[model samples]
Target: MGDVRAPVAGLPPVAALVLAAGGGRRLGGRPKALLAYRGRPLLEHAVAVVRGGGCAPVHVVLGAERERVAATAELAGCAVVANPDWASGLGSSLRAGLASLPPGCSAALVALVDTPGVTPAAVARLLAAHRAGAALAAACYGGGRGHPVLIGARYFGEAAAGARGDTGARALLAARAGELVLVECGDVAAPDDVDTPQDWARWSGQPGQPGWPGSLGQSG
Candidate 1:
């Protein structure tokens, strides 16, 4: 692995890592990457969410139906990481994504495909936290830590090592809880993730309804 580059003058570049490899067992084995939010695949929306938040060179980790998703999703400029052990759990995908990141990235702002409620503004908040010298940070909803956690490059190895089963970075976060910065984002975004048919219906409300993912644009 190449050495992680240090920030030159301003905020270091933060890459967005989208974990879209989950096979939605609760949704009848549907691949979460292909889940529809608006008219585009959820993965596309996820990429857009990160891009809009100012994260450059997005990396998307694909597991379930990798080929189909690669062919169908609009991932023009994003790096795709194949997770063959996706069936193992979210941790596998998280590890794969982190491993695929280039050395130029100072940090990775990890996001999930099923989180349609997470907006660019919320992502920007996490990026800001990283810019403010936080090595680890997470968005807080109602004072509870939530998705789109930002992990500094220095902790990538520990994070990948601790990633197992469906825990993702939970173990690492818990181990270094004191170092984690929580940025309140409940006002800008919802942390609810789609896991079941009911969740799908709830998040995929009518086009014009409030909190609709498509209201702002084709992105999530």
Candidate 2:
């Protein structure tokens, strides 16, 4: 393993990867990116959370109704990537997002658009782990590991290679279980994601819930 030393200066450059291309099969063919949350698209909210957490050069992967999402959302500063095989599953979007990250990023912080409950605090905690010499880290809610996973640059290829079907980066994380640092974030964030109509209703029912929508992006 390469030296996982803490940066001598400020935190290393960590890029944000937002996977917002799901077609929302269970939600009646709606694009998850286009779904409204707190009067804004979930994509916008997800981007804001990561940005607020300090990740730079955000990259967004879009699938399903990519064009519609582009037109409907405010994605000004993020690099938008379109995945043609998004119908395959979440892994495609993950691979695309990772591949889209620019050079010089020491790591990639991956966020899912449907996971509205994940807050900027949770993202910051994971980043703190990265800066503290952890090469792999994830948010832990109630002892269960969850999203906005932080993947060191060294593992990007392995992560993208193993991201298949709906597994996303599960294979890589599982394979590196011993190295994975689980940062407890239950006190700061929720892991709920909008998958079905019931899930959508539950998410939409609460508009201004604390930590639900951090500073939103114009086009996250």
Candidate 3:
């Protein structure tokens, strides 16, 4: 809601690859990214977080609800890239996003549409780790690794070289664990992702409920 700018230091010309190509079967075939939460679409929150993280040239991969998602993304000032192989799974979307990154991107910050609670600080920490020469960086909360992962250009070819079935960068990161950095984030909301109506209800804190983070305040 305010003027968003890239972080001044410890952040390179990073591109954000937001994966929103899922079919959302658990959401009754509805596009999860378009689902409303706290007066805004879930995808919009994800985009805001990425932009707040100081990533430039954000590319959103759309498939299940292409037209609707693209229009929403365009309104949010994000570029949309179609993922025809979305039926194949997340790997296809990831590959498409990677291929769409700008030519001079020094690194990429990847986020999932369903994981709307990831914070800008968490993303910034990942970028800081990557800029410090880590091949791979991820946000970790209470020892569990979470979303909005960062991958350096050093592994760009390796990530893009994989088959379209790969859903995550696990293999690539595992092979280079010695160079991986983990930023410990105490916020549980950073890993919260919506999959079912129950999940949404819980996150939104319907009337008598208490949600993760106890209360939703500014997460930056």
Candidate 4:
């Protein structure tokens, strides 16, 4: 695979909130974000996609494997924020990452650490739609919505404040359905997340699949 370089267009100054606080119970206590596929931690691949998509000031929320997560973030050259309330669920981590965003960010690109397949192109597409005035834009594949959803500044407060327990921005998106824009992507990678060992195995076999790491079996 090519070097994980920033995009030539240079990502906008939007902040990215990478949710990496989940305890990988399904994977036998293995931190899902730290799981390797194609020779790189899932979190590292996820961060590379965000960086390649032209988003800046990326912040990763660490919880279950805080040290490992923080180390990955440091290696990626992105900021790391601890989500002490991670046991409460994804919403809390989302809130923590959002709160850590630097001042003046007009929008945020949110991605899950376990979702390493979400592509930089899909993320850039979401950013384009958001910049084009969509209140919320998500990447869709095979008729299924997926990660790296872009939320404009208009709903930042609502997303950050309305989230509770494990209830995330889904509620906000449902409440503002009329303002949502779904961008169709031919790549199934956007919708594929490594939740179990089975998922990792299946995705590993499909390295050519869109949204997945280009170097499926290469060590980073």
lDDT of 3 at 160: 65
Estimate, for each residue in 127-161, the C-alpha lDDT of model 4 and write its tens digit: 77866777688788876666668888778889988
lDDT of 3 at 57: 75
Residue pairs in steric clash, candidate 4? Answer: 11-54, 38-216
Compared with the true structure, what per-residue lDDT tens digits does model 1 show for residues 45-134? 888888887788799999888998899888998999999999999999999999998887889999999898888888888887788789
Model 2 residue 123 lDDT score: 86
Q: For each candidate, what is the lDDT?
A: 0.84, 0.83, 0.73, 0.73
Best-to-worst ranking by lDDT: 1, 2, 3, 4
Error of 2 at 160 (Å): 0.9
| Candidate 2 runs further than 4 Å off | 1-10, 206-220
TM-score of each: 0.88, 0.88, 0.85, 0.84
Question: What TM-score does model 2 achieve against the real structure?
Answer: 0.88
User: For residues 138-173, could you state the per-residue lDDT of candidate 2 as single tens digits?
Assistant: 999999999989999999999999999999999999
Model 3 per-residue lDDT tens digits across residues 97-164: 88888787888898998886787777777776766777688888888777777888878878766535
**Model 3 score (lDDT):** 0.73
Q: Candidate 2: lDDT over CA atoms? A: 0.83
